[model samples]
Target: MKVNCPTCQSEVEWSAESPFRPFCSKRCQLIDLGEWAAEEKRIPAQATQEELERALPDIEEIEAMLAQQGDSFFRDH
Candidate 1:
């Protein structure tokens, strides 16, 4: 089967042989990655404040945990 590459719009073979199945080549794949990294492409969604709060740790909690863990927490594990 063949499908259009999301990055370059080139036809790509959807097979195990094609390492970048959804993209034509590594360049195209990287281009797509760059776009996502740069926030040029975004997944459409509407998140509530409650959802956002639940998804992220509080800054105070993070600071307290880091203070308790100390520098060794990052170096050792």
Candidate 2:
């Protein structure tokens, strides 16, 4: 099977012989990695309600936890 490299659009043999099967070469692979690292590429989606809830603690919950901990949280053990 063959597929175009995602990074360079070069034809690539989809096999073990092609280590970078989806990319033309290490350079192309790195370019794609860099783009992703730089946030140039991303999967578009909205966070689900469950996802949003799990993303962070509620403000009241945070305050309660902080009150429970008092100033001990600021001290080093």
Candidate 3:
């Protein structure tokens, strides 16, 4: 049975158990990902949960943000 795509409403001919069930083709999958990346339709955080946990926090790396914070804030640190 053909499935209707939620985005373009095009018919997809994927088997029920196919790994690529939702996306009819690789191009469609990549296009969906591009939309998400370009739109930034995800949680708005300074960093993702995985990134914040895995990566080391560096003040120098975010020096521009540092400049905005008042000296009193850093002086307290």
Candidate 4:
């Protein structure tokens, strides 16, 4: 079997003889590692509940915002 290297798109044999099955050479493997380390490569994911909560405005901030808006914010029409 053969597979293309994730970094260089070079063909690599998928076997025990091929140390880096998904990468053509050590250079290609290192390049892919560097991309990941630099945050250039990322897996799509949803924010965790804790992360979402942390991003939301706290009670104090919400109150401050409401105070800044004043009574008109509550007035209908």
The lDDT values for all models are 0.51, 0.50, 0.42, 0.49
Ten contiguous residues minimizing lDDT sum, candidate 1:
40-49
lDDT of 3 by residue, 7-77 (tens): 34456776855344465543333334334433433323343335433442333433434456433432212
Compared with the true structure, the alpha-carbon lDDT of candidate 1 equals: 0.51
TM-score of each: 0.46, 0.46, 0.37, 0.45
Question: What is every candidate's alpha-carbon RMSD to the true fold?
Answer: 14.4, 17.6, 16.9, 20.5
Q: Residue 17 in model 4: shift from native, Å?
A: 1.3
The TM-score between candidate 2 and the true structure equals 0.46
Which candidate do you rate higher for lDDT, 2 or 4? 2
lDDT of 4 by residue, 1-77 (tens): 89977755667899977776677655444434433333533312343334424433343444444456573532212
Q: How does candidate 3 score on lDDT?
A: 0.42
Candidate 2, residues 56-75, lDDT tens digits: the string is 33434444544565735322
Worst 10 residues of 4 by lDDT: 40-49
At residue 73, what lDDT does model 3 achieve?
Answer: 33
